[model samples]
Target: MEASTSERPAAAEGGVAPMVRFDRVTKRYGALTVLDDLQLDIAAGEKVAIIGPSGSGKTTVLRMLMTLERIDGGVIWVDGEPMTHMPGPGAAGSGSLVPASQRHLRQVRGKVGMVFQHFNLFPHMSALKNCMEAPVTVLGLSRKEARERGAELLSMVGLGDKLDHFPGQLSGGQQQRVAIARALAMRPKVMLFDEVTSALDPELVGEVLTVIRKLGAEHDLTMIMVTHQMGFAKEFADRVCFFYQGRIAETGAPAELFGNPENERTRQFLSAVLEAG
Candidate 1:
């Protein structure tokens, strides 16, 4: 089913605009449509959890927002500016969306950071070095400044003692925590977590979740996470979006959606996921 603007929260209420907005966004892979005219809004400092069955386009949302994937249609607005398109003439962020230049993409992408399912760390770099690399190279921070920032973040994620440890030397949970710290080192306004714990051993999941929970509690970031950890989502997210067939089947506050889902698909999904656990 096609999602209408009516289904989404107002893009801007009062004078405040959303930190992120997907305006009639669409994505396709060959003949298969992955996201069908999706409309969604996320306010600053809000934590949103996207949950759905495999192939329902949950991960696609994060990947696209992080610009790892491109949309076939529509604009993606981030920090009140177009991330997927170039802002038109005159005032910044004005007029119609147009295809963005690579320079435009790189400029806008700096405001968002993503942690993937697999810890895509540099095999040869130490945890702290991995965190320091981008800040020094991309953001042009002094190596000393980047190193200090990286060490602080690693400490925040409970890896202060493992600064010198390579990804191979770290446990799966430890590696994922380092990944989270590395993302934070970028100082992004928006953070994307794509099933960050999915690659961890079952016993390792809690430690990664603990670091994430700590970051959420203390940070003012706009976080969008694709996760299967229902209990954590129910507890952590300000809003829960249940996706089905490439559109949002249902969305609401955690208590409302998880406790009393109105959509049949959402209800069935939650029931099955809960039962499976």
Candidate 2:
């Protein structure tokens, strides 16, 4: 499909704007394209789950939003501002998708945080220090204030006692929880979970999912999770998107998509996943 940029959708009847939008976005590695002219909009405070077989571009979607990967074409808008590009000088909303400057990117990225499958914690730092580092260094919080905030977040994820523990001393699940707390310390408006439990032992998966469930239920943050855990997705997500070969093949409420998938590919995929489980 050819890439095309388009205007943002009008606000909902309630006048609430969408928090994120992908307008005819595309990604490619040489001749092999991953995302093809995709379009998706996520409202503020919405919980969305992206699920599909490996290499279906589910993870790529999150990576793109976090600015880890650059788009080959089209634009991405965050909080109604261009993310993949900046407005031209004196053009005032009339510019093309030129590359965003580092300053612009950093400003836009402050509102987003991501948790990876592998616990990417610093081995040398204690849980408290790990959580406190970014907010102190990047967000400019004082050492005392960052420490207090980090302690509270660690406690929220059931790690109040593990504050002084190093990543080497913690189990995979505990380490992942620390990672989540670290992300939360940034006070991001949007959170991305990319197969967060995929690297954990089968028994430890539930612990991490439980914390995520709590976040979804209690916090007003917009969440987009790319997970293979269909049951959890159905339970926690307000909307579920199924991707196939980089395009959104099907999307709807969890109950409808998981219970009675309208697309044949979705049906086949669900059947395969269910049987594997």
- Which is the leading candidate under lDDT? 2
| Residue 192 Cα positional deviation in candidate 1, in Å, after optimal superposition | 0.3
Model 1 regions lying over 4 Å from their true place: 1-11, 88-94
After TM-score superposition, what is the CA distance of residue 20 in candidate 2 from its true location, in Å?
Answer: 0.8
**Residue 15 lDDT in candidate 1:** 57
lDDT digits (tens) for residues 1-277 of candidate 1:
1212122224565656688999889999999999998989899999999999999999999999999998888778888777877755553433544577789999999999999899899999999999999999999999999999999999999999999999999999999999999999999999999999999889999999998899889989999999999999999999999999999999999999999999999989999999999
Question: Which candidate leads in TM-score?
Answer: 2
Residue lDDT tens for model 2, 165-230: 999999999999999999999999999999999999999999999999999889999999999999
Clashing residue pairs found in predicted model 2: none
Model 2's number of clashes is 0
Evaluate residue 34 in candidate 1 and report its C-alpha lDDT on the 0 to 100 scale. Answer: 96
TM-score for all models, in order of appearance:
0.94, 0.96
Clashes of each: 0, 0
